[model samples]
Target chain A: DVKVTQSSRYLVKRTGEKVFLECVQDMDHENMFWYRQDPGLGLRLIYFSYDVKMKEKGDIPEGYSVSREKKERFSLILESASTNQTSMYLCAREVGANYGYTFGSGTRLTVV
Target chain B: DQQVKQNSPSLSVQEGRISILNCDYTNSMFDYFLWYKKYPAEGPTFLISISSIKDKNEDGRFTVFLNKSAKHLSLHIVPSQPGDSAVYFCAATDQTGANNLFFGTGTRLTVIP
Candidate 1:
């Protein structure tokens, strides 16, 4: 079975602070994604990495950026944490098109 | 504008019953549909999927149906168990799929014992 792990299961950050959420996948998938889920809004993509050092913006990439320094690791960085940025962050990896994604446990970020 | 929609925000079902979660999409170009189930504090996991060419796909107790004309698809869970309680999300991809997915507002399912 494929495993996707996130650095933290819960996080709290002060306003204007920088926040980083890390994800790593055991499988050698080519595609990695970052998503934030909110109540009433569901999961919205923040960013996705197709390869090491390669990234693409998702529909809701504002205020967020991502880095892929290694094939197994992807990181989400928030330049300035805001209350609105608090949400459940998820990481996923996929091998190819139309294939189902393997997801990390998730990080619940709270910005106060 | 949200391309995918799940009208029902929450659903409750009795154990040993059938639970149906519905999803609708506005884009006609979407050719692949998938269902994901997420537990509290966990990421969404792939449940089942159906291709546009076929209307129905099944995996044990979980089955997914697609209606191209209606641009609607649904997930049916038979003999629902308490373990099935979770948030069900409907997702789609255009012909190419390439890892980008449009997801619907998830439906929280509660299976009563």
Candidate 2:
């Protein structure tokens, strides 16, 4: 079974503060992704990394960035946290060969 | 613009019955469609998937049917149980190899036993 670990299950940050959400996958998947889930909006992609040191912007990449310095770890950075940024953040790793993706438990963030 | 749409916000069904969840997409480039189930406070987990070439794919009690011309797909769960209650999301991916997925708003399913 594949395991994806998220650093925090819940987080609270003040507005204008920077936030970092970390994720790690046991399986050496080539693709990693970050998404934010909001009510009635579903899950929107923030950023994705295909390989170490490689990154790509998804549909809603504004105010968010990602890092992949290691093959097993992916990090999402919120440049300046705001109330609108508070949402359930999910990290997923894509297994090759049509196996689909494995996702972490997710981190529920609240910005005050 | 929402590329994928799951119009129904919620669905209620009785145990031992079938639960059908529908999804639609507007992107013609998408060739792969997937269904994911997510429990409260948990991340979404992959449930079933169907490629564009195949119209139907079944695994145990779960089945996914795809209609290419209509750009629509549906997931059917037979003999629904209380454990099947959760939010179901419809997702699609294009052929670009970017691994980015477009997802719908999801449908919250409640199974009454």
Candidate 3:
């Protein structure tokens, strides 16, 4: 089984503070993604990395950025946290074609 | 504009009955569809999937039916159990592209005992 681990299960940060959400995978999957889940909005991709040091912006990449320094780790950075940025953040690693993705347990972030 | 839509926000069904969650997509280019189940505080888990070439795919008590003409798909859970209660999301992607999935808002299914 593929294990995708999110460093934090829950986090609370003050507005204007910077936040970092870390995700690490046990496998060698090259594709990793960060998404934020909101009520009635579904999962919106924030950023994705296809390979080490390669990153692409997803649909909603306004206030977020990503870093993929190594093959197994992907990190999402919130430049300046806000109340609206509070959401359940998810990390996923693609297994391969047709196999779909394996997701981490998730991190619930709250910005006050 | 949302490319994929889940019209039903929530559904409640009695245990041992069938629960159907629906999804629709506007993009005709999408060639692959997938269903995921998410529990509270947990990331969504891949449940089942179907290729555009096939109309139906089944796994255990879960079956996904796709209608290419209508650009719609549905997931049916038979003999629904309490464990089946979760948020179901439908996603679509064009394999020819970057493989970025377009996701629906999701439907919350509640299985009553």
Candidate 4:
């Protein structure tokens, strides 16, 4: 089974502080993605990396950045965290032949 | 603009009955649609998917139906079990990026025994 693990299950950050969410996958998938799930807004893509050190903006990538320093690890960075940025952040990895992605348990972030 | 829409916020069905979750997309470029199930405090898991050329795809008790002209897709779970209760998300991808998917707001499904 494909397993995606997140570094933190819950987080609390101060407003205007920078935040980093880490994710790792054991499936050796080439594509990694970061998404924030909000009530009534669903899951919006923030950033995705198809290859190591290569990142692309998704439909909603503002105020967020991502890093893929290694094949198994992907990180989501909040440039300047705000109360509005507090939400459930999810990390996912996708296999080449299939569109189904394996997602992490998710990190619930609260910015006050 | 919301490209994918799951109008239903929640749905309830009795155990052993069937649950149908619907989704629609405004973008014509989207060719692949997928359904994912999520439990509380957990990430969404891939349930099933259907391609544009195919109208229906079934895996076990789960089936996905796609309507091309209408730009709509629906996921049906037969003999709904209590364990199936969760939030289901509808997602789609276009030719431009096979890996980039747009998701719907999702529908919370409840199965009562």
lDDT of each: 0.92, 0.92, 0.93, 0.90
Q: Which stretches of candidate 1 lie over 4 Å from their true place?
A: B95-99
Better of 1 and 2 by DockQ: 1
Please give, for residues A1-112, the per-residue lDDT of candidate 1 as tens digits: 8899999999999999999999999977778999999988999889999899999999899999899989999999999999999899999988445556888999999999
Query: Which of candidates 1 and 4 is the stronger one according to TM-score?
Result: 1
Model 1 CA lDDT for position B54: 99
Q: Tens digits of per-residue lDDT for model 3 on B1-113?
A: 89999999999999999999999999999989999999999999999999999999999999999999999999999989999999999999886534368789999999999
lDDT of 4 by residue, B1-113 (tens): 88999999999999999999999999998888889999988999988888898999999999999999998999999989999999999988874653468889999999999
Candidate 3 residues A39-92, lDDT tens each? Answer: 999999888999999999998999998999999999999999999999999999
In candidate 3, chain A reaches a TM of 0.97
TM-score result, candidate 4: 0.93
lDDT by residue for model 4 over A72-109, one digit each (tens)?
99999999999999899999988543556889999999
Docking quality level of the chain pair in candidate 4: medium
DockQ of each: 0.69, 0.68, 0.73, 0.64
Question: Can you give the lDDT of residue B56 in candidate 1?
Answer: 96
Per-candidate clashes come to 0, 0, 0, 0
* Best lDDT among the predictions, by candidate number: 3
lDDT by residue for model 2 (A1-105), tens: 899999999999999999999999998777899999998999988999999999999989999989999999999999999999999999998864355678899
TM-score of each: 0.95, 0.95, 0.97, 0.93
Better of 3 and 4 by lDDT: 3
Candidate achieving higher DockQ, 2 or 4: 2
In the predicted model 4, the residue pairs found to clash are: none
